[model samples]
Target: MNQSPLVIGARSIDVGYFNVKFTLGRPASHGGPAPVGNFPAIAPVLRSGAARHMEGVAQPDGCVVPINGVTYFVGPGAAQRGSGTDARLVKEDYATSDRYLALLRGALWRIAGDAGDAGDAKDVVIRRLGLGLPLNTYFDAAQALRDRAVGEHVVGAGANERRVTVEQARVIVQPQGTIIHFGYTNGGKPLEGVTMVVDPGGGTLDWYLSERTTPYWERSGAYPKAMLACAYAVADRLDPGWRDQPAIVDRIDRAIREQRSSFTVQGQEIQMAEHRPAVEQVLDESIDQMLTAVGKMDDVDHLLFTGGGASVFSARLQKRYPRLKKITRMDVDPIYSNVRGFQVVAEADLASAKGW
Candidate 1:
């Protein structure tokens, strides 16, 4: 008789400026609510009883979706809800925000369900979760994000109007999840010499040098110009005044990330392909800075690239620096590399506990 593969559920989750990625023992999935339009602190309306009822009521507060008595609005949906009067379109303090927490918990519950064999809703249980943060985040800050994430439980709507409870969840971090992934993909090979890890995320572009597989912390830093900036660059081309229009900004962000051929402008659809040059230009500007930094790192034998931003612009990056072919280059699906790496780390831990 043939043996079946073990059906264990271990997932790595990455919440970035562009999207929320979840990589399981199986394939990866990137879907969660993002902010609906360009409105500050407002997320798109998530479908709920109250929101459904007020669909056509011209909701000033946007459509509110309450979870555990805390209201929220998910991304890429109808209606919208603002975080606060002074909320931003993309918050740097996302890890601790109630709305963000609601989103994270909701995503985790869905990922768990995707793992299958989901238990009944009556019993609250603890689950192991893996998380990743940008390279620039200090150890203390990353720990803070992890600390806040663990032991977190939330009650919210799940598939088919079912209620989901995730309790006492534990979260761990291996900064940039991509590093873990690189190690696994290389057949657990020990990295030697100078290796440059470039992780360009939604909100930041970060890189570091590693010697013999250990990161040289002193050489690593982060830049704010990243995927979001690329979207902004595209928006600047479509309309010089687009910043004032939140919905337009939202559309541009979705269009660029989703690779939509066109985006709406003032109720009119415009071809995004026409502005491709502008997008590439903005991305090139960011990557150039990263390359400049790498050049100062003496002699690098390997270059590892991961992150949605990197995935989005890798082809262009490679094209610009054909010399990239000279190095021991590794470029996986930038979106899930980090999360998948995290999953691998979690699995190793699980295996060790079972003495495997």
Candidate 2:
């Protein structure tokens, strides 16, 4: 009798414009929840003595990693060390950029460190890796992204250097991950009828129409009208000079996510409530465009929302479609919905391959 192939490990990475979310699939013997993590999407190259300076300053939420002979500061506090232009927001070729790889390697390094797999100075082998792309980029860039992700990678530098090998990779439309998560967490069954998933993230507003898990590509699409656009609009209203400040934009992004009435900037409190109209206008327009693109959805049984900007877009969406459902998983934040679902999908495939 032939033996089943051994499944080494699996990982899922969702690198959005605002954050990088990831999960590592643990074996059944581990007997605990999946290991997951996230950090800011900023990955700016470190210059000259910056890395040495970073060593002295405490950065609990950030780390430095070397990719192809260049070092980058990646994560929450990374943006503070670089100019605003360092962040490649709204770039059409973002997925193929070095910063994207920096964020990807940063996540892998953290995961390997947390798993204690990097201490042995050996490669951490991932048998399967799952990734996500905006709906608009899925068809055109998915294959290229997958090719870029699979194979050996050296993350970090010097003593912290860790080798990570991705043997296989899978890329799917970003919003589809949310639905997979909803279906798996709800009842371990696939969805039925016409279900629409709207994922509002930092860079793009992606939506998908599916019938019992089969996607309707004609109706599925993505656009650049999302949280970043709202932030820019808010910045324009608050201060024209603030338009070039990525840090200020980050604060605005957080304030919108928290639904805060006001946010403090340079010791001055800026009332977000006053600028609500500007923010809402952008969201409303995006929703209108999405609705028109998807055509009629009267047959839609469930309308779901997921992503970092979900809370910010929820109220507006609910008023438009009363049946809209929010995808919720016990301890998982909405921002992590896609990455978590990607892990679930990869693990399920591994199980099937192993005849489990």
Candidate 3:
């Protein structure tokens, strides 16, 4: 009798427009939390000639990945050393773009490296891979996204290269991951009645309405006005030229997240207090649009918030719905909620497949 290949485990990668979150499921022996992390969703392409020179430099915050003959420096510091072009992908077709693949591969490379599996011939094989698509695109693009994800991928370059095989992939509406995560963390108790999840991300404000876990497709959708909208509005007021610079937008986002009244730009300190009204105005408009889409909330038993912008919109959401509950805790960072839920779902599916 032939022996079957050992199933290492499952992993999830939540690739958002502004950031990429991932989770490597916890080991059986460990009773603690799973290993989870995230990096900015910036993948700067490098020409073959330039990539060769990068081999000698040390990248503490990011890595260089080669996929399909193209090279990209992905993660935090990548934008600074990358070519002068904007590396952030905000287009609707981003799920199928080269930059998206590069970020996904780069994240796998990082996970393998951190787990001490880099350069191993045996490879790090994830039995199941969980991913998410924005509400607006989930219907039309989820299948394509899953197809791209479920396969063998070689990440990194030369000596740093590592093989990662995704045996299966599961794609869900981005915000749905939060509810799944919420239930998993709360002792597997099923959510009662109707639940609405409002996920404010960088590029979109995605909402999902469901009774328990079954979705109400008609009431859920995404709005393009989200964090970037505030960033752009603030940028336009600060300097119209800054609107095109993702780095500037990133800085503004950080400031907004930190609740800082000022930020630095090209060695000069810029006051952000003047831009508060603009940010509030845009956020208010986004909240109105979200409310309009979800219609009456009287039937909603639980109103939850998640995603990178969860905290940013928490106040407005709480004020609007006094019963609003944030899908976050002291240990759970809202940004990683989706990927964590992905891991939970993957592990459960794997268990069920084996009749465990």
Find the candidate with the highest TM-score and give its number: 3
lDDT of each: 0.56, 0.77, 0.77
Cα lDDT tens digits, model 2, 264-316, are 89899999888889999999999998988999777787677778787777778
C-alpha lDDT of residue 168 in model 2: 84
TM-score of 2: 0.88
**Of candidates 3 and 1, the better by TM-score:** 3
Write candidate 1's Cα lDDT for 94-207 as tens digits. Answer: 665666555555455445344445532322332345676655554545666666666534443343222333322234333345666666666676466877777776677778
How high a TM-score does candidate 3 get?
A: 0.89
Candidate 2: worst-modelled 10 consecutive residues by lDDT: 324-333
Tens digit of per-residue lDDT, candidate 3, span 1-356: 02332346678898888888888668676444568878878787777523444677876466677767777887667777565446354578888888898889878776665654343333677788888889888888899988988888877666666777788988988888888888777777658898888888998988888998899989899988789888888888868777667788889988887788899998999888888889888888888888888888778877677777777887766666566554322225577888888887888878888898
Candidate 2 backbone collisions, by pair: none
**Poorest 10 consecutive residues of model 3 by lDDT?**
324-333
